[model samples]
Target: MVFEYILKQNGIHPQNDLTIDQSIDFGSTAAAFAGGNGDFTVEFEPGATSLESEQKGYVVASLGKDSGYIPYTAFCAKKSYLKENTDLIQRFTSALQKGMDYVQTHSPKEIAEIIQPQFPENDLKTIQTIVTRYYEQGTWKADLIFEKESFELLQDILLDAGELEKRVPYEDLVTTTFAKKAVK
Candidate 1:
């Protein structure tokens, strides 16, 4: 959808100019591109960084940097679970916000060291690169607030893709109360 948005921005309709080739996985997509089967594919994180490092691929553009604050991740809960676990949710969001705060203040190397234990199979260098890229991109939000503009951009993407029949109100899609309190 982001790709479609970008294409449209450049006055190219994806349906007309692009041939959609769906790959089951990033590795396969990279492999296909490397093997001359396709011209380009979008890759994320370690894979994208690794490909460039190994001289297998080069990035044409960074979607995150170009699009600006697309809100890639969200915490969701069932209404029943949310109603019953408001305190738990608050605690979790608070901890997450604190972690974001830490990332914002610390060097990428320091942040990588803190998370390296969980990714034992990945080498320190790769982890550090990923962390550095994310830090430089401002990928993590210190505040949990779900911005209406970002959500509306997402909705526009969905609508353009024909995935949404009509615009959904922000109030219906999100509850900002907890996020508001969490930031405080």
Candidate 2:
């Protein structure tokens, strides 16, 4: 959906311009591209960096940087559950906001050092490179707020893809109250 939207935005018809190999699963795309399966590939984070580092692929483009605002990650909970656990949700959201703040304020290498424990398989330098790439690409926001404009853009993408039958209003699915009140 994202790739198709990007293609259309750039005046390229996804269906008519080129054949995008949808056969490769998300995880295997880097390896497949490395094996000469596709002319180009869209990868996120470590995969792209790893590909270039391994001399299999070249980092050419950034879809997210070019795609505009995307509300890719959200902390979702059932309304009932949310109502029952507002305090817990607030704390969770607050923690996430802090994480965002940390990413925004710290250098990529510094952030990488702290997060290296989470990804033990990757060496510190690789983690730093990945962090630098994401940081440079503006992947992380300084806050946890899911803006209405981003929601609308997502709906537009979904509508263009024929995945959404009707446009859902942002208020119906989003609430910025928690994010707004989240401890800074």
Best by TM-score: 2
Screening candidate 2 with a backbone cut-off below 3 angstroms (N, C-alpha, C), the clashing residue pairs are none
lDDT of each: 0.83, 0.88
TM-scores for every candidate against the unseen true structure? 0.91, 0.95
The superposed Cα distance between candidate 1 and the true structure at residue 179, in angstroms, equals 1.7
lDDT of 1 at 60: 74
- Compute the lDDT of residue 26 as modeled in candidate 2: 92
Q: Could you give candidate 2's per-residue lDDT for residues 126-179 as a string of tens digits?
A: 999988988988888878889988998899999999999999888888989889
Lowest lDDT sum, 10 consecutive residues, model 2, at 175-184
* Candidate 1 accuracy as TM-score: 0.91
Alpha carbon lDDT at 34, candidate 1: 67
Cα error of candidate 1 at position 79, Å: 3.1
Runs off by more than 4 Å, candidate 2: none
lDDT of 1 by residue, 142-171 (tens): 788999998998888889889999999988
